[model samples]
Target: MPDPILPLQADQIGKTYRQGATTIHALRHVSLTVEQGEFVAVMGASGSGKSTLLHAIAGLIDVDAGRVVIAGQDLSLLTDRALTKFRRSRLGIVFQSHNLLPSLSAEDNIRLPAESTENLDQEIDDLLDRLRLSARRNHKPAALSGGEQQRVAIARALICNPAILLADEPTGSLDSVTGAEVCRHLRELVDDQQRSIVMVTHEPHVAMWADRVVVLKDGNNLAEFVTDGRRDPQSLAKEYHQTLEGEVVR
Candidate 1:
């Protein structure tokens, strides 16, 4: 039997931009694959192309070369309308900003992405319970804490039962303790629900929550290391910097 289609496959994707007389290669033949139920974090310094790669994988921007396939469907093959619909159905995106409406309650915010509200009451309730927001379901964004607001964003993303969840600095705005809470919730989503996630973060503690870390440098995939049994953030930081410095990590 043939192998099953992967959740995400970004094949040698490249992107470039021209700044007046200078040419900038934002991404250069960078490839990444995310399997089912895997949590992968991409780390890099400024201008390292990690954000570019995330945008490419999210189908938010078209790559200059290569192709991005999500759940067996090629993004380049879809028209604008079809791509929008496909993205809404198959991809969940969370950003540093919670992006929740200040006037809407937590429950209503999560309901915004549902194509059909038929039989959604239980699902929303389940998500609220799962995210430990059952008591705050009726609270508006202004009434919620930062971590709570971000969790609301996460629930909204999951409302569509997306094939993959793409997060860009999901905990960037919260305090350290609150950020760790959010990360733990994300980790639970992967461990308990078998969700596939790809996140971009510069913090070692944030990246450590992922099952694997992919480091990018100078628009190239520099190295990657599994986080399993790697409990020390200082060690991970050392390895990450070493990788960025063009040194091999044992």
Candidate 2:
């Protein structure tokens, strides 16, 4: 059989910005691939280009060089209109803020991504149950806890049944206990539903939840380590620091 196609492939991506005569390199030859059912975390310090890499893969911004392929479709080749449709149907994104409308109920929030509600009742219902928000389906954002609201956001992202889930600081706003709960749900989505996730998080604890962590430094792919069932956040942090230290000495 042929090798399976990757859920996401980013090759030699580079992006830069200019302010007058100053050139700011946000990313430098960064490449990453996420496999099916795998959870990969991108970790970096501030200004390390982690978020830039995520935005590049999601096609939120254009990369000056390289290409991004999602589920076999090359993002750079698509026209503006086609890219919009492709992104909507192929990628699921969760951000730091729940971004839920205060006026809409949990179910309504999840249904927002649907092109039409007429035929999506069952799909929305199923996603609500899967995300464990069935009971809170009628509640508005203000009526739900932080974790619940985030779960609703996840459900909204999944409603389209996208091939890959891209999250940026997904648990940044939640308490430790609630954040852990949300992480568990993300893990289950990979293990049970065969979903692929690429998350950008600065928190070691959050990165530990992933199967592998990819570290970025100074706009480069610095290192990566497999978690291998190690749940201790400190171990990951130590490894991250050591990787940076090694680079410094080189």
Q: Give lDDT per model, in order.
A: 0.93, 0.92
- Tally clashes: model 2: 0
Top candidate by TM-score = 1
Tens-place lDDT per residue, model 1, 41-62, is: 9999988998899999989998
lDDT of 2: 0.92
Please, what are the lDDT tens digits per residue for candidate 2 over residues 1-250?
9889899999999999998999999999999999999999999999999999999999999999999999999999999999998888889999999899999999999888777666599998888888888999999999999999999999999988898999999999999999999999999899999999999999999999999999999999998889897789998898888888874332
Candidate 1: list runs displaced more than 4 Å: none
Position 178, candidate 2: lDDT: 97
Cand. 2 TM to true fold: 0.95
